[model samples]
Target: MANDNKDFFERVYQVAELIPQGRVTSYGAIATYLGSSRSARMVGWALNKCSSWHRFIPAHRVVNRKGLLTGKHHFPGGETMKELLENEGVQVEDNQIVNFNEVFWDPSNELL
Candidate 1:
């Protein structure tokens, strides 16, 4: 985690925590929600280290802009990320959400 940007990381966690069960969001959507449209990769960076946090963060709900489980490798087990999503009633195929637009939860639009 970037010590100087702990606040940013915390903000990312905050939004991640709000993602509804069975729904997903993109790192770029979260970054854009935080008024940092260019910080999608930073959002991913923050989520990659969320395991160290004391509280639970639904990092699995955040995927790449294309609805791909690009962060799956960051999860503990081989299929942990996909399993988590599937458990939430979100279908995945070939590491991509089956119904991305239907399950996508855009913070900018939903949190308003």
Candidate 2:
């Protein structure tokens, strides 16, 4: 079980790292790209632990299905996630991304 969880987390990190600046994906999108559509929560869990990684993972580029910064609280500083996205030219307001679909990056489509 531990190995399985670790593998899942590693895959999550890989996908998170692949998220280009100025683009974002949802937890469900990453999970679905990994062939585990039901594991959206697991994707979020893996990203939550990403701070321990040696290299920086763009976990900030991930949001909920509704383009909501649901995991923002997990970041070290308040509004850090929002700041990161805005730095990448993704406008965020009221904790929700503006023009979400325009900035949404789908791994399943891009990686194909």
Clashing pairs in 2: none
**Can you tell me which runs of candidate 1 are displaced by over 4 Å?**
1-3
Q: In angstroms, give how far residue 19 of model 2 lies from its true place.
A: 0.8
Per-residue alpha-carbon lDDT of model 1 for 8-110, expressed as tens digits? 9999999999999999999999999999999999999999989999899999999999999999999988999999999999999999999999999999999
lDDT of each: 0.96, 0.95
lDDT per residue for candidate 2 within 1-112, as digits (tens), equals 4999999999999999999999999999999999999999999999999898788999999999999999999998899999999999999999999999999999999999
TM-score of 1: 0.97
Best by lDDT: 1
Candidate 2 — worst ten consecutive residues by lDDT sum? 47-56
Model 1: worst 10 consecutive residues (lDDT sum): 1-10
